[model samples]
Target: MEKRVVVTGIGAVSPVGNDVDAMWESVRAGKHGIAQITRFDLEGQKVTLAAEVKDFDFGDRRAAKRLDIADQYALVAAREAMADSGIVSGENVDPNRFGVYGGTGIGGLATLESEVSKCVKKNTPARASALLVPMMMPNAIAGNISMEFKAKGASFGIVSACAAGTHNIGEAYRNIKHGYNDVVIAGGAESVLAPISFSGFANMTAMNPTTDPDRASIPFDVDRNGFILGEGAGWLILEELEHAKARGAEILAEVVGYGATSDAYHITAPDPEGEGASRALEMAIEDAGIAPSDVDYINAHGTGTPYNDAFETIAIKKVFGDDTKVPVSSTKSMTGHLLGAAGGLEAVICVKALIEGFIPPTAGLQKQDPELDLDYVPIQGREADLKYVLSNSLGFGGHNAALIMKKYED
Candidate 1:
């Protein structure tokens, strides 16, 4: 028999708030986390804003020394999650059975930038620190997380662009369901609001370069222009149902289904027909042994880009049909696109919505787009007795993922 997985703990360091309770409060209130970019100088850049995690201090948790920002973000969330799950100590628990799955779309970009600047200006006199490579490595986030927590099973980073975070969580669910591990720490971490990342997105015209921060990242709206970049980390502790029960861990939600597909059409744009995204959603529903209408709330992959919003609307319509009556919204309107970290952050939002029985609103969506006619909880968040919510993410290279989280009953 296949094992069952339940989420026992969730920790997040998002643009809205740092801890799970604070972050969920902001998300439930439909607050936008977007603000001017302050991670680096934005003097004359076309895009001058992003959702940055403010005042996060991760001290001597990893090595009693310096660590990369992304790794630190992951470690911070991991620590909270372990504590929440009552698995902080591995004395009786088998460390070999604990696993860690962390991801980031563009890992260590900030650290890389800093080191490059150092190499050019100051490296003439001496060699850069040996820590540069480890600090700047993309996989360092996962490795460091595993080392910090001493997770002995399945420790690695799975980078699939914006889908990286969600994919990590989903993969962790799969591992636990396969009986490989009883507990898993999984999520995505990102800190890519650096100068080069901003400039590249701006040059590619992928970012919203408007002066009005409130109106930017308005998904499912005709006036929507582009996605606003954001930074943060999210971690969730997945434990076997029996394990959680034995430990008296609080169950947040149950991971019922996960599906992934490749659009195989565009490098940056989604298939106009949204065939892959639609298939991915349908597969997730099938995996959950549920029908289309069984899903009550849909946390859309609405990226605020013209192509993504339109295509995702079509995908939802294809899968849900008149079930379009279902409540759908993109929290990205508030949190901005955290890229690889988006899946993990949005997963938390979905889990919280399932537990709280309220669907968070897609803030900043003032005007509705004609092409994308879906029941978007625009501007104001709504209260609903939601049981299952589908969280979706479509990333570059046509990666599409869908996860279904159901309210825990037993």
Candidate 2:
């Protein structure tokens, strides 16, 4: 028999707000987090806007001078998530039964850039700042999170570019389900609003040209140019079913199934037909032991890119086929695209959907593209009774991940 995995808590330091309540309010109210670049100067970049985390102070979690922003963000969000799980002190919480798994697509880019500049001007590397490996390495999210909560069961990172968050959660779900650990801190964090990061994405033409935050990230819309780069950290606590019951933990949502696949075709683009993604979705449904018709809501990885929207729509249609049982909405339309943190943040949205039983609308969706014919809860958010929510995320480098979150009944 396999152990069941359930989400006990969620925390997010997103572009819009600091914690889950504020962030979800911003998302539910259709507040756009994208704005003119303020983290650094983006005067000449074609894309001068991003969905950046605002008003985030690392606080007592760590001294500002001691850690990189990426790791700080992870710790801050992890603090909230651990508290939400009702196990913050980590005392009496079995250290040997807890673990950490986190990721960041572009970890601590700002720190790396500053170090490089110092070396070039001074003709010698900064020995004091030499821990740049741990600062900028993608695994730093996991390392920092482990230190914050002293999770000692197991720890690692999943670097799947943009799909990192979802990948981390799915793999963490496996860790708990297979009895590798009873609890896992899983998610992704990112802080890549640097000159090189922005220019590299812009040069590839994968960024939204719209300067208006209100309309910048409109996935599946006819007028969408591309994704508006976004940044944040989202963390969730995945506790084993038996453990959660014993601890009297509040079950946010049950992670029923997780499916992942590789496009094997492109490092930057998905297959035109979305065949790889389509298969992943099907596998997820099967793993959940649910028919396609059982899924009620789909939180799509709609990145507002022409190819991503069209391809994702085709993939959704493939999973549901003629049934069309699920209503799809892309919260990225409001949060912009969080890259490595996309899946983690989206997973929080799904869990919230199951908790609140309301599906958030896809903001900025004024006119739909004919290519995306499925019913998108567009324009305004909706209040609905949700039973199961399938969250999907496809990353660059041909990585695709799907997770099914269902209302916990038992």
Candidate 2 per-residue C-alpha lDDT over 1-410 given as tens digits, one digit per residue, 9 for 90 to 100 = 68999999899888878899998898888778888989887678889889888887877654666677878878888888998998653564688889998987777888888788778767776553857667878887898788778888888889999889999999999888998888999999888888888889999999987778877899889999999988888888999998899889999999999999999989899998898999889989998999988899999999999999999988888879844857899999888888888899899888888899789889889989976788889988888888889999999889999999899988
Clashing pairs in 1: none
Estimate every model's Cα lDDT from 0 to 1: 0.86, 0.87
Candidate 1, run of 10 with poorest lDDT = 121-130
Best by lDDT: 2
Q: In angstroms, how far off is 249's CA in candidate 1? A: 1.5
TM-score of 2: 0.97
Q: List the residue pairs that clash in candidate 2.
A: none
lDDT of 1 by residue, 54-120 (tens): 8888866556346777777787877777777787638635799998888889888887787787787
